[model samples]
Target: MQIIIVGCGKVGSTLAEQLSREDNDVTVLDINGQRVEQLVNELDIMGYIGSGISFDTLMEAGVKKADLLIAVTGSDELNLMCCLIAKKAGDCLTIARVRNPEYSRETEFLKKELGLAMVINPELTAAGEAARVLRLPTAISVEVFAKGKVEVLKFRIKPDSPLCRMEIQEIGPKLKSDILVCVVERGGEIIIPNGTFVLQERDNVYVAGAQKKRRNFLSVSASAPDR
Candidate 1:
């Protein structure tokens, strides 16, 4: 995909590098000449020095031929303007990073009004994920899907925990809970465990199931007395 990214701060440069690595033709625009030059040399992608809201700069960055344009400028308003112009000029899919909490609440309105393909609020997303993890403190990390009806959790096995030396097949019967053990990370190696696979101490286990069921399983398993 031919991609144009506006802004050269940490997020913009990192996005350029990753997209370029994925074989996308990425062109970045930033008013900072040093930033533009540095990313151009480091990532071997095109860079333009100009304001992203300028139509001339968008054209110079090949926005007309771009498959996608991502605007992540420091200012929410500037990012929105860049996407608006890119959509008008290129008719390409557009994404904008809108961080201001006030603007964040009107994401749907902004997307509909601006013809945006996506409105990315990184701060809001990070906060939501952090809240999910905090809600399930027993898990090392937590990811929710299906509107929080389902969840995937990762937790490490400690020596005295009931799950430390348990077999995958025993969890449902022993713990009286139904959950899918998806992946296990043990000693720097990843394993897709089978029914008979035994879990060991320090192994990082990933489980997925209905949110309530998974939460119950974690609570019951966590209640086992330490030896």
Candidate 2:
């Protein structure tokens, strides 16, 4: 994948580094010569120091042949303009970051006029994830899949928990429920085990099952320690 990223701030540099690490051909653009030079020194990427909204600047950054174009400039207007121009120049998947709460709101006018594939509000997404974790502190993390029909639950076993000594066969049947533990992380190793695998203390367990049975499974297995 060839990716063109505009804006070389902390987030932009980090994104470029990660994409480059994944072996994607990445090009980054920023108006600051220092920023472009620093990113060039830090990561294996092609970089251009110019305004993202300029056609010549973006073309030099290889936007015309880009598979993905991400514009995350500080101003919402600049980001929008970058996306629009990138979209018009070529058939690239475009993503724009909009900070203003009002500009991000979807309306008939926006959906019709703006060729925006997606708009991201980083602050809102982070806040929502934080709120979910705060409420479900018992679970190390949570991810919903299968259109919300299934939930992937992660929680670590405590030293004193009796279930640590049990095997999957014993635990699944004994619970009098349908949830099954799918993955286990112990000593920094992850395992996809069968019924024969025995769980141990301090192992982070990931369970996947129907969402309807999730509460019952968590209530019997593990809990978050009070702060």
Which candidate number would show the highest TM-score if scored against the true structure? Answer: 1
Query: All candidates' TM-scores?
Result: 0.85, 0.78
Which digits, one per residue and each the tens of the lDDT, describe model 2 over residues 1-227?
A: 99998999877888999999999998999899899898988896788989989988887778778999988878888988998888888889888888787886663345357677778878877876787566556788888677445668888887766577888888767876687788998898989989989988888898877655766677777655433
RMSD each, Å? 3.4, 3.5
lDDT of 1 at 29: 95
lDDT of 1 by residue, 83-167 (tens): 9999999879999999999998898999999999999988888998889877777888887778567778988887777887899
TM-score of model 1 vs. true structure = 0.85
Candidate 1 accuracy as lDDT:
0.90
Worst 10 residues of 2 by lDDT: 104-113
